[model samples]
Target chain A: MIIPALIGSLPRPVSLSKKLEQYYLGRLSEEKLEEAYREHTRRAFENLRRAGIRVITDGLYRWDDIFNPLIRFIDGVEVNGLFKFYENNFFYRSPVVKGELSLGENPIPEWLNVALEIKEEVYPGAVLKAVLPGPVTLAYHSINEAYESLDELAEAYAGVLAELMKELPVELVELQEPALAAELSRATREKSDSVSAETAKALIERLEKVKALWVVTYFGTPRGFPEGVILNFDLVEGTLPENYRGDLGVGIVNARETKMERRDRLVDKLKPLLRKHGKLYVTPNTLLDFLPESVAWRKLKLLGKLGGE
Target chain B: MELQILPTSIIGSYPKPRWLLRMYSLYELGRLPEEDFREAVKDASVAVLREHERAGVDIPWDGEMGRSEMTEYFTAKISGFKFYGPVRVWGNAYFNKAAAVSKLEYSEPLVLDEFRWIKANTTREIVKVPITGPYTIAEWSFNEYYSSKEELAFELARILNREFTLLEKEGATFIQIDEPAMLNHPDEVPIAVEAINRAVKGVNVKFGLHVCYSNYNLLADYFDEINVSQFALEFANRGFREMEFLKKLTHGELGFGAVDVHNPRIETPEEVAKAIRKVMKYIEPERLYVNPDCGLKLLDRSIAYQKLVNMVKGVEIIRKELAKEGKESIPFRRSA
Candidate 1:
């Protein structure tokens, strides 16, 4: 019996005050944020190690915004003002892509560099994983007020992200393509939804350039997957809804409400699903919010036991 | 019809009922107690609705008393889809890829059933019946049945239309359709607006649209699309940046969120009065209704009550101010 492994990227919360101060002070001397990020990355690895998770990530500990942190590394992107997502109280700022996209000498964010360093330092033998926003998801989430078309912008982003992927030295890279699954309301989809297909194709092509890719879809159904755009990805991950029969990374534990029985049932549900798929990987519903240490441990134990048995 | 004003607002109901937390399994056969659950519905309705009336609210909702969960409640009632589980918020939207617990087959409209239950139990004339609109329901859930979200939304609208018609026939005077999803998918505004219009077609009742925590920049243009008599939005809690756009976009009545519902701290009457004053610049005092920023379901009972008291006091002060200035004042009254 091949049991699924538990793996996830845990991002550390950065205080808004500290992030602003760092941004305004022009303090790029020794990568101060990157140094602070290393400590958090160490703590995350230690936590995952204690929980017995075999496949670990730096938990994206160094970055302030998940997607925008890469702007510093990318050559043509200009940082803009901040915007708040009122529902969740998360903040994001836009980055303007300038003319003639050229790959930065370094593709990984300074935070990810610290994460990679921490992984080498802390868990020399364990697998190191890195995550980046999918080029398509990033393009969609970004404010395109300056860009003429999302398709044009997405193509540029794809090239940059693909080049960046080659530079990062990690076993696996998860490209979380959340926007691909977004259902454009009928009104807008009728006019602009066609761009999504091209965006999806461009993104998949970009990820194909990167090795050991996991194309993760979340937030919507996989109903309208673009036709004839097979990129031979190593893995696809998402919390399958209850009625879906497609391949899924079954999420049993409610990230909001932690219940042991719920977690067990989630594992039970995954057993059959995993049997069908050769190797399974389990991830919680989301990573932004903290899952209690106990729940994380239980999931890790379940995955480890499956692997061992 | 005489308007009755009540004093009490929100009471705490935490550790949500056990059935609500069970995902779509709550509606599974033999999983939940049918009669006992229905009784609990009645009890919840009486408890919250009566409490609001006693507390002097102009209109009272059962506090979403009949629903299991906010977004997932539609899965059990809508056809061609299944409940995946709770949706997790991602970049700008919510994502749920969980498999369906079971295929959805709606024999009757659940919202109608719940509305009837509430109407049968309550004596208040203007019991606010809250429904999750098509755009919100589709946006919040995992889309499985239709190839496109628009199709799924229209289907939801048809079901809601049935429920709205039923409620109208059953003497429901006020219906509030909640559409928080509009904030995330601004492109869905027109689709949502059209769906709502279709749902409430031929219904001779006061229709209110509730959108919370959205950037008013996108919502400024919403009035042109939606056919609602009133737009009840979060303004006081969100601040006054939206009022300018609201003044330009809205031609109908507005419900100014005067109290913060998510925050635990209670506002003073003076603070509430100040917030209302800011809103009055854009909206006429007669066209403005004072309420909490969002639903009080998340707040503790004491804080909710205190907020309501302050909100009502603020409205009274505003009314007095308008009267002294020779401006027409609309008295706050509850449904008779």
Candidate 2:
């Protein structure tokens, strides 16, 4: 079976973006802002239905970045300064771990409930999936003032995320682990590699206790992922490991650039992989929010074509 | 051209008047005529230039009123670039990002017309021209066509070199290449330095490198290797923290940031003087230029004007102290 899905996040429409800004500046009421979020969430699902995506999300319209929802709702976490999201032009507020980490009153369950209601209304048969920052990526992207080492930080993150995942209504989830493939300096890379692997192993053990998950890596080389774990590789900047054997995510569509991908050429390239792997997922190389709304829409149309619908 | 000790200036952008912003929107939506929009831009530029002069700025340009952004404005003029749509840089702000579709070429003179207009309008003998640097353009744009980022940057450098030569030929004295995107990738510092050197190659004029909101430690090692006359850095936002980094920058003049442009509270001259005093221990007064941390485009016009006022008044305090030692002025060198 071939699945068509997005990595996570869709660019909010300019109108919703304006409303968000107004809400931030206290010019708009929270009730009015919630109306905008609901309206935009409905619009996002409608767009996904138009693109014929089966496995979809609620567009993560409220998330400024991958770390946003976690940093806001998790205990022992404080928002720190902005750090560049890898080498891309975008930035995210770094989470500073202050004390023992644990899941507090998370908004994901409510968010997922809203998404499930929208899915049933907009596209009844669609499978709604949740996405989160993997422990390894979260650990490295943060400032570790409290944890003795990054391994301990990531282990704590894994435990907190596992507890959060159990509360989510969705069965399938994606843990974005870009740090596994991130390009770092020689010294930092060496230090992070072992910690990243250990963190990934710990996360796999914890999440497996709840439900199956997909590990998505982008923007750099893909490695260190355990076998039998479903994986996604950003083929735009990375190559799939030849020795890996599992359900594969072929990320052929370029998300960072505005240029369109050739649909026929990509379909032909994935044919061989589809024959070898029983389950294959087609996705964008990175988050679609990197592109403009118009461009991202066109890319989704292309993704629909690749779904062979 | 001669400059007084601690010559005060801005890092290019000033807040656009609200009326001008409205007109700019109308022009974008095709509600206003192009000729009328051009006239409004001229009026705004003159308005900002006069504002800087009133604030006691010694060296003022047109405040970059003719352009909306640093990278987008330059890439829009250069050949072989295509804009898809706007992308978010941060909260509520978006820039029209472009992708390089082919080899970059110098189709027309970028920023030359702006420089010419400002040169004719400003009373100052020497006006500072800020152009977006090549490495910044390459780093910010989507590189679908280039084999590597370094190649694209070098191609951009070759194109910018032509623009610099044209500006120099047209009698622009000082040109500051703004590369706020440089330190984002510390490993790319070598490429950035090489690209900068190539961009200013054979252009015999004073050039300043302006970078803000970045870790200066990345460039501290290659400060002298970059072929520019001045290094305009941001300090006020960080509370002038890490003043020790100035010791590593052995060459080039320093555009000392004394007023925090990111903050709305108008800094008192005493506070600015104290900040300047801390850096004066490392750099001579004649080699240090005082300015706001970065562009004042984000602040309201009234607040921006007051900040510059305080910045100049702060420099005046230091100037009096230097005058006692007979070191109140220095000749502006064309190149390092």
Candidate 3:
């Protein structure tokens, strides 16, 4: 049955965040830090299950934030150059591709293992989702000194992602391409439509082994994409009746703001639209990490009430 | 013979003790008393001042000890500004944003207590007071009262003017208005400049404006009109990319940044010297005051302290060489 699912990255409590920062500064041990970070996944999954949601993500507690760990795992890409993350105060380290971009051996699977442990602990054999940046978002964010063109860079990213997906045990994976939104870059405005569509199609084809491939667009309304996998647009771009057919992840909650919403109100918003689609999953429009931890928890509970069986 | 080549100064705010942050949180949660909070803040300011003295900063400020943020902290002190809640900056990082619901007023000089503490604790004759510029305070905040952003900024400027005027009257030698948002809102530079001019009105102290992580080329035309004695800007963060922008400045000396504050890799004295050499190409050493690219709040205390030490060491390397060449630093100027 259709249910509530996470886009990725649950809100990290400020105390935990401070611990992580301290870990980076060598004030805390690796084992203790992992324990702290991994403990949150248990709570995240527990909250998910209580919300009557089966499909979930690890909440990426270990990820130094998205676009990191992923780009840092690659050999040729040096994590340099800080770009403002949307209008947010957070800065993402831009991947500077000096040479060939290939995935290096890392502990990403181990992170997945921690989440899988939580899955086994409570909701045994439930679908666990993994979120990664889409090829377009990666190539778009990168400063390429080696690649001949952006198209080539996107292709390289696709090949690496396919490899990662094959190795990981995630039942579903979401590609977050918020950069497809125009405000990020002017070049995105003029070129993203055609280039991103091609990139998304190419990536979807490459990741044939993954159980489900979802391309989630946030921040901007993408005009269109080539048909392949489930396309999840944010509240701004997502609607019912006309667009819903195969499947839809209805973003019933706004993730950017800290306003708590009622479950009944959300269910009402989705009730009419849910029937139109062959499958529908309710979700927040973007990462819940932007909101306060308490507010995020309340939103998750709201999902439990509305998206529940 | 010129003044200390690359006279070192902080871009305000040193690494605060973890206890102060904890106490502030406790105070917010109503677990700590006001007297204890104030005492802790004064102690933090004293600690930061001692660190600056040890690092040999020529113009050290009070370290903005009780400041939760540049905007919200000051806004909390000001009348008519109300905070809704914290807004996310990034991973687990947030700054509580305030909205000017009523006309902003300079209810009290909030920094007076901290300034008084700095005066009592430190032996230094001159102390830099870095306040949020009207444009930045307006730009950084959510405006619910003012008709336009320009109007909000102007009103904020009037408030800041009252504060700075008090600081000048109380014998402040150097006052730096931090406008990190200046280049971010280029469309309103003229308005921002006017607001800034209004902020420093009738203040006779050596004024400085701190703007970091920005393209300085954008401010060329507006430089002379900014009404400040110094422009403290970041260079090491951009790999010293915009060094040529300094030559376009018609007024104000340069508060050149040599250390990269955001990076944990403590830059060597040689690395600091190399960055200063690039700045020397655009402006004379006499007009240069070396500092870090930005505040070292994000960095660890050890890293921040060492970077400042290395920055001073780097300036000493060049200073020694200049002395060998029969050039000595002139007496430090209180104003341009």
DockQ of every model listed?
Answer: 0.05, 0.33, 0.17
Worst-scoring 10-residue span by lDDT in model 3 chain B:
B327-336
Estimate the overall C-alpha local distance difference test score of candidate 2: 0.83
CAPRI grade, predicted model 3: incorrect
- Evaluated on chain A only, model 2 obtains a TM-score of 0.94
Off by over 4 Å in 2: A74-78, A98-106, A183-196, A208-211, A226-229, B102-104, B144-148, B184-188, B215-217, B236-247, B257-286, B313-327
* lDDT by residue for model 3 (B265-295), tens: 9989998887777778887777788888878
Q: Estimate the overall C-alpha local distance difference test score of candidate 1.
A: 0.58
TM-score of chain A of 3: 0.89
Model 1 regions lying over 4 Å from their true place: A1-55, A58-125, A129-309, B1-33, B89-106, B120-123, B325-336
Relative to the unseen true structure, what is the C-alpha lDDT of residue A181 in candidate 2, on a scale of 0 to 100? 84
For model 3, how does the per-residue alpha-carbon lDDT over A130-241 read when each residue is reduced to its tens digit? 8888877787777777887787888888888887877777767888776555324421111222345656565655664554687677766765552556767677444433
Tens-place lDDT per residue, model 1, B210-268, is 87766666766767667777777776544444466776644666777877765678888
Provide the TM-score of chain B versus the true chain B for each model in turn. 0.82, 0.98, 0.95
lDDT of 1 by residue, A1-309 (tens): 333333344433333224434555575434555555555667767766665566666665444555656766666676654344322323455565665456666536454566767767776656776777767766665545445787776777778777887777775776666556652322111224234675676567556656666555544454334332221111223334345433334333333323334446555665675666545555544443333334445655554544432
Q: What value does DockQ give for candidate 3? A: 0.17
Sort all candidates by lDDT, best to worst.
2, 3, 1
